[model samples]
Target: MGRELVIGDIHGSYKAVKQILERAAVTATDRLIFLGDYVDGWGQSPEVIDYLLQLKSQFDCVFIRGNHDDLLLRWLKTGEYTEEWFNHGGRLTMEHYERLPADKRQLHILFLESLQDYYLDDDNRLFVHAGFTSLNGVKHEFFTRMFFWDRTLWETALCLDKSIGHNDPLYPKRFTHYKEIFIGHTPVTRIGETVPVQKANIWNVDTGAAFKGPLTIMDTGTKEYWQSDPVHELYPDEKGRN
Candidate 1:
């Protein structure tokens, strides 16, 4: 099988991202898939987006759209509602760009809008930002929304229900086709939080780095996991730093 390393959400913590990649020893022969949320949360949205775009040009990078990314895209498109966007770590995103000049900000906005929703490799591995859809009964709309909004999948993972939250409105049909499904969006305090469950080939790599948890990376084929220190230190006085 090919070398495939699927990564979890990166909320603009460049340090965490670098550590995970270095630990995984990613190479040209290996496929690196990011589950999305590449921006927001932390203060490096501009840097993170620029870095990912560059990596896409040089390496095999697959980026799926996360809810924050989609909201950021919308904010850029029409400058519409900003509550939900900023409330969920969008403040850092704005702060990241507020330091940039107009031209650079426009360039970054263009880059953000260009990201795709999902990527499927020839291998039986699927990379999605959120959870998967239900088998045979749900519509594409449901799947699309869940891709950016589902959280039950993470709970199931924590509960060790490997079925990948089959009860979720978004659990996909027939996980048998893929050897594993790489997902992000849920932030667990432990890497082993996802060790259980059947029916869904899920390998959740979101360790809640932005939430004082380690950033996560895992090899889809080998299921090897790696973690990096949270970019910023979390203390009792700074409970909401991220």
Candidate 2:
């Protein structure tokens, strides 16, 4: 038996990813569930993907799609680099791809294309890159983009009145759908925390590796975790997504 590790948004910090995984002493038996945002932000966006591809060959891994990933996929397929995407870390990712051969770029495209919108485990824990909007649950989510772009679900969990019992009519139906939810998008650093935050039944593991924080990986079962040194420290010259 091995641990089930849920990793937060990477945002192209390959150095951070390597550091955290080694620090965690991850093995082939330990299942790695990545919460996405693997690219953009840092200068190593392309390198991150290469490392992830390599990891899949040696370990059990689950990849989730994110908003930045969707933007990257669209850019790869159409060569349409929008201003909004460029301003938000896409520029770094795009520039990296410029040096790659066509075959390597295609491989990245396939990997990105195959990412899941959400993953549900036997334990009934939900893993999504962002949040789902469906009251019934992820399977019934109306918009595909909501799985990677919606912040309302996290906001609802963060703002919910803890005094409201689970059975109360005032309780949000979305909260009742899973045993626990794990996500990464809006970083916990936004709330002044550099660690995973649990609000209601949701665990936010994104510790702001895209900017000044570190990349984190949590053992979903034990809730024990390991974090890389602050990403900015590892890549001191890069502006990252700051």
**Pick by TM-score: which candidate is best?**
2
Model 2, 66-90: lDDT tens per residue? 8998999999999987898899999
Candidate 1 lDDT, tens digit per residue, 81-198? 5776777787767766667888887887777777766677787566777775564312343557777777665555455544446466554444544556667776655443432122
lDDT of each: 0.68, 0.94
Off by over 4 Å in 2: none
lDDT of 2: 0.94
Off by over 4 Å in 1: 137-143, 154-177, 190-200, 234-242
RMSD to the hidden true structure, all candidates:
4.4, 0.8
Q: What is the lDDT of residue 63 in candidate 2?
A: 97
